[model samples]
Target: MTRFIEIRNGRVVTPSCVIEDGRVVIAGERIVRIDRAAPPSTRSETVVDADGRVVMPGLVDLHGDDIEEQFAPRSGAETDPTTALATADRMNVLHGVTTKFHALAFEESPEDGRNLENAARLARAVDRGAGALGDNRVHARCELADASADAVAALIEEVDVDLVSVMHHAPGGGQYDAESFERHYVEDRNWPAEAARSAAEERSGMDDASQGQRIDRIGELARRVGVPLASHDDKGRDDVETMAAHGAAISEYPLTLDAARRAKALGLATVMGAPNLVRGGSLWDNLSARKAIEAGVLDALCSDYHPASLLAAPFVDTGESLSTRVNRVTRNPADIAGLPDRGRIEVGARADLVIVDPSPTPTVERAFVAGSEVIRASAGSGAAPELPARSRTR
Candidate 1:
């Protein structure tokens, strides 16, 4: 028997318009109907009174790395992959992210535990935890300067990777200025000043020939596997053109307005981090996402490192219609990620929805994935759920 659920009297946010006093009917894993008039509820159907709350499609986060927090909560503490992923899944659903791409970085960073081997292990863990609530996918971040192309290609073949983002995080360019690079290495990584300086100099002096070869090989592999390709922290027009030539259809976190505009002109989807929108600026002091949105250069917004930002960023005063702002987190990212089944409240779409109360902070009251409720506000009071307990390992 197909499961039936009816959510009535909510403000349904569609891609084209908002339906006031709307009703959404879910049958099994798909949405069967969405109308202003409530369909007659049968005894077998579970009826939920949304009380005029905002009922919108669940978010599609293309580049969230919050899972890294679960994997390694601190510098030395590491949780088992399965447990970490399970925790991450619950957190994502609570934040209305039904489809999330875990942006795992393949860099030569044994000090930080973000090495190629760890990337492969985490991908395997994501594969094993397939039964989790949200659609967990892998977005392999191939560091052009550190990871070998052959290793990335092998990892892609070994795991069910969904997206591949080519990035060159060398110091003195592309997301890191000289001063910021030194600060990050010394403060964030806890490296000594001399060691950090030496590493930055070495990275800055890397041969372009080797970097280009690695980029070409990873691009070819992504193309061959049919995974969507993205370029991370693009610097300018030339960087955009280079990524376009390498077959990257998505430009993730372009560092400058010029790069974003150029990527849009080149017909690549431009993705910015949602935290930038909520915080009103970039943490790295780069281009502002709000400015990109205002200039009509931004195509989508991801959770980036903060999953909660994905849910609240759209609700910020962007001067656009609710549907248009909502699409930044929903349909736009889904379209960029090549997922047609979700990110919409249309008929026959997957029933991934979030019921949110537009309070001061905008609480996620309830959430569903494929017609099944995965997160519900505690006591139906529209309060956020308490953080899950973490077991300490000696």
Candidate 2:
């Protein structure tokens, strides 16, 4: 039973060049051909006319935490993990994110239910929903101060974890500047200023030796599982050096240009938040992702907490070529994650594609994963489709 899909009459974007009026042929789960010639099509072969739109690689988001919003939309309300993850899959596919690493924090944020136990529950749910619309993977964000290294190791063994990142959110340094930490605690979390300060102080005062041991343990687990490891919120060259020493292959949202450059020099792929580029700067007043891009330190862009930003961030030109910008969300992250089968439109690659209408407003017209049409835009629906809206590509 051979399945065939032909995407014709589109500007097919590839790693090196964009082919105009090209056709891509998908056989089963892999792209079998790409050419200007119109290949003979059987009646059983499905055909998609791109209508002169941009057909590019589906985005690969290496780090994103938007699933937190799905499970706990409000302070006291919580949805079932299965329901929440199913909802997330639809949203991710609509935004052209064919592959997503759901960043789950293993910390004690009990008020928001983003604790270690909840993370494990969500990971198991993701494993259960493995046959969903998009490629869903778990990215464990281990808080160094949490002292849950052994628990995280066990959880990785129990679940299908794809990535791990070591994070330290002590108040005075890294991503959490003093002002930002205070605002987060007082304004966002609605905590008393004194309580916030005390918590920050407590986190900062954790035994350094214990924190180092925890990081080492998780790093070892990542190696054992053969998953990529990352460092989050690196503050400076020293921080980058330490993480690199612990076998961190990626640097997730380094707080400063110096840190990003240092990580790149040390052979770590640097990931920055797409929201920072879309919003023009960091919400927490950290180093700007756009600036990092201009400085040539930014390697890849992740949705972070907003899935929409992944598709929209590439449209923001920061002096990089169009292919390079698109690669930040596609090929680069895929390569970092060690997924060699996807992230490009080439012969023998996975048929993970995104069709975008880049005029008026950039919109995802349709998406396909593994040669199967997963999402499609409705006629006359010029605006981006909301999660509730449904359309079948076939």
Q: What is the C-alpha lDDT of each candidate?
A: 0.85, 0.84
lDDT of 2 by residue, 107-153 (tens): 87665576788888888877767446788888888888785576677
TM-score to true structure, per model: 0.94, 0.93
Q: Residue 236 CA error for candidate 2 (Å)?
A: 0.8
lDDT of 2: 0.84
Question: TM-score of the candidate numbered 2?
Answer: 0.93
Off by over 4 Å in 1: 379-394
Q: lDDT tens string, model 1, 1-394?
A: 9989998999999999999999999998899989995555784368988998999999999999888779977766778878888889888888888888999888766555667877878888886664577778888888876754667678766677888998876676798888888888779876678867877877788786776777788888788878888998999999999889888899999989999999999999999999999999999989999999989999999999899899998799999999999999999999998888889999999899999988867777888877888777874555667433222110
Report the Cα lDDT for residue 92, model 2. 88
Q: List the residue pairs that clash in candidate 1.
A: none
- What TM-score would candidate 1 get against the native? 0.94
Off by over 4 Å in 2: 37-40, 192-195, 381-394
